[model samples]
Target: MDIEKTFALLNETEPLKISTSREITVAVMGAGSRGNEYPEYGKLFPGTLRVVAVSDILKSRREAMAEKWSIPADRVFGDYREMLEAGRGGKLADILLIALPDDLHYEPAMEAMRQGYDILLEKPMAQSEKECRDLARRQRETGVMVAVGHVLRYSPYFRALKKAIDSGLVGELVNIQHQEPVMYAHMAHSFVRGNWHDGKATTPMIVAKSCHDLDILKWLAGRRCVRVSAEGGIALFRADKAPAGAPERCTDGCPHEKDCPYSAIDIYERKRWFLYVFDLKRDCPAEEILERLRTTDYGRCAYRMDNDQPDHIVVTLLFEGGVTASFSLDAFTPWGGRRTRVMGTEGYIEGDGKTFTLHRFRTGEAREWSYAPPEGGNYRDSGHAGGDLALIRDFLRAVDTRDFSLLSSSIEASVESHVMGFACERSRLSGTKEDV
Candidate 1:
C-alpha cells in the first residue's frame, strides 16, 4: 500500500468540485429539515440544479420553501399527491426528492417514479422489508434513477475509513464494534415526544435510527449480512418512571422542570436547540418559542408521553465470510455521533465521527486523521461532514449523464441494510436469530 496516498485520502479536505452539463430541476414532497438540505444545493451551485416545485402538509413549511426558492404559487401544493399528479408525465421537474416522514417514503417514491421522474428518497426506504424490496423492484421496472438517503457513505469520515480499509490498512478484516448514541435531548424531542416514539406505529427504532449504521457496516465489510440477533427495550421514558409530581406537560408547571434533564424548558427555552423542528429560527423571540412549546408535543414531559421506542438495543450481525459485528444503540447520552472500531489481522482502526486512529501491527506505528472545517468557513454550511451536499453533487451528475453508478445510495445497494434491520427486530421479538 502507498502509505502517503492512504493518508492523503484520509486527510484530504478539498471541496467536491461538481460541474454538470446543464441545470436539473427538482420537485420536493416535504419541506422539513431534509427537504431544506437537498434543495439548498441548487442555490450553492446555481444552474447546476433548480427547485421548480414543492409540497408540504405544513402550510408554513410550504410557504417558506416557496419564498426561499421563489417557486411560483402554482408550483407549491398542500398535498404531495397534488404535486406528483401535476408532474404526471414528467412535466413538473427532472427529479423528485421525497423527504417526507418515515411512513411516507415507499408509496410517494413509487408514485414519483411512475410519474416518469427520477427520485432521491429519504432513508429506511420503507417501514417493512417487503416495501423496501418493492421499491427496489419498482426502480428497476421504471428504469428511473433512485437515490436513497444513506448520506454517511459520502461523508469525509466514512469515505476515508473505507479507503483506508480498501488500501489494506486493515488487512483481512475480522470483527467490528459500533455504537450509536442518540443524544438525550434529541431522543426526547424526536422519539419520546415526537413522530417516531412508537416503534410499531412507525418504523422500528432499529430501522428508523440505526439503518445508516447498519448500512455503513455492510459497506465497510464489503459483503451482505447473513444473520442477525438483537435485544432491547424502553427503559427510562415510560410513564411509570415519571416524577412524583410531574404534570402531563412540562409547561403545566411540573416541579421537576427546573432540574429534570429531559425538561422541554431546558432544551428549547434555555438552550434553544432543535428549534428547526418547529420551523422557527434560533433568533426567534423567547416568548413565542415558549408559546409554541406550551401547545405542542415538544412541551410535554418526556417520561409522560405515550411513546414506546426502545431506549437501548444491542445487535449481533454475521456477514458473509464469517465476518462478525456487534452494534449497540442507546438513547441516554449527551450527543449523537457514532463510535466504531474495526479489527483485522494486520491492523485496527478507531473512529469517533471527527477523528480516526489507525494502528498497524507490522510497523508498530499509530496514525490519526482528524476533520477540520473548510478554510474561512464553518461545517454548519452542510450536514454530516458535508456528506449531504456531496451526495447532491453526485446525484446531479448521475441525472445529467444517465449513469446510476454515480450514486452510492441507490435502491439496490441500500436495501440490504433494511433487510438486516428487519431481521434484527425479528430477533429481538422472537428471542432467536433471524436469517437475512
Candidate 2:
C-alpha cells in the first residue's frame, strides 16, 4: 500500500459511501460499556448502521441494549454462541461487534468470521500471540474485514501529529518517546481491585493496557517492530504493602480509609461513573453501591488485593529500518493521558494528547497546537478523545465498501503490534531482549 495515498484517503473530505437507502445491520456480542459506545455511532448517521441483535450475560445490560435497539426478544440472547447460531438461519448481521473481555475475544471473532460476518474487534486482538496470529489467518482465509479498536490512530490529535511528521517538518522519523500515565484512582479501580489485576489470568499489562501505545508507536514509525526489551515489576498495590490494621474489604472499618488514596469508598462513592466497571446500572442508589462494594472485588483495598501486574513499566523497542522507540506506563500518576515526543533528523515534536508542539531545526522556533473539543463537550465523555466515533465510522465504510484501506486499524497491521507487546512481556519476565 502507498503510504502517501493512504494518508491522503484518510484526510479526504468526501463523505463515506454506504448503501443509499438501506441500513447496515449490526449484531453486538457484548452489551458492556464499549459495546454500547460503538453502536451509538449509528445514531450519528441514521439509515447507515443499525444494531439489530444483542447478547450479554447480564440481564440488565442485554435487556437495556435490546430495548434501546428495539431488538425482539427472540434475538436477545444470554450467550454469544447462541446468538451466532441463531444468526445462521439467514439472520447473520452484516457486521459483528465483539467487545467482550480480553480472554473472550478469539473464539467469538473466529466464529463470527466463519459465519460470514465482518468484525469491529476491540483492541489487543487477543490474549496471546498464537490467538492474534489465528485471528489474522482466519481473516485472510475467510476474506472478511476486521477493524481492531486501536482508536488512537483515528483521533484528530494523532492524525494531526501524523500529518505534521509526514509533511517533512520533522524529516525522517528516528526515535519516539511515549508514556501512558494511568491515574491513581483509575489504576486502583481497573487494574488493582477490578477485573484485570492478574496478568496470568487475563493478560500482561503491556498487552492489556499499553497495546494502544505500542500500536501508535509502530504506526508512526511506519515499520515493523523487530525487537523489544523491557523491565518492570509490581512496585505497589501488593498484599505486603497493605497498611497495618487494614482489612481485605475497605468497608470493614479499615483505619487507613481516611488517608489512603485507593480507599474503595473514597474512590467509588465519590464518583458515580466508576460503578460502570462493576457492570452496575448507572445512577444506582448509595445502598446498592455499598452492598456491591461489601461483596464484590471492586470494594477490596488496593494493597490487599490479589493483583500482580506492575504498577509501573518501561519498554524499549527497535523497529525495522533502525527506527527506535521507548514507552513507559506509570499507574501512580496524578493526571491521566498520553505524552509523546517524536524526534527526527531535522526537527522534533511533543504532545500531551490534547495539545502538541512542533519545532523545526532550521527555524529554531516552535509552533503549538491545542485540541479544543466542541462546545458543551468533555473530551473524556467519548472514549479515547472521540477516536471511538471516528473508528466506527471508518469501520462502517470499510464494511460497506469491502476496502481494507478504509480501516485505520486493520487486523493485518494490528497483529504486528500485538506481537511486539508479547515480545516485550517475554523480555520483561526473562530479562533478555526478544525479537518480535
Clashing pairs in 1: none
C-alpha RMSD of candidate 2: 3.6
For candidate 2, lDDT tens digit of each residue in 275-358? Answer: 776666667777788888899998888888888889899999999999999999999899898999999998899999977887
TM match of model 1 to true structure: 0.96
State the lDDT of candidate 1 residue by residue for 305-372, as single tens digits: 88878889999999999999999998988988889999999999999987899998999889998776
Clash pairs for candidate 2:
none
Q: In order, what lDDT does every prediction score? A: 0.87, 0.84
lDDT of 1: 0.87
Locate the minimum summed-lDDT window of 10 residues in model 2: 9-18
Candidate 2 Cα misplacement greater than 4 A, ranges: 1-21, 278-284, 372-381
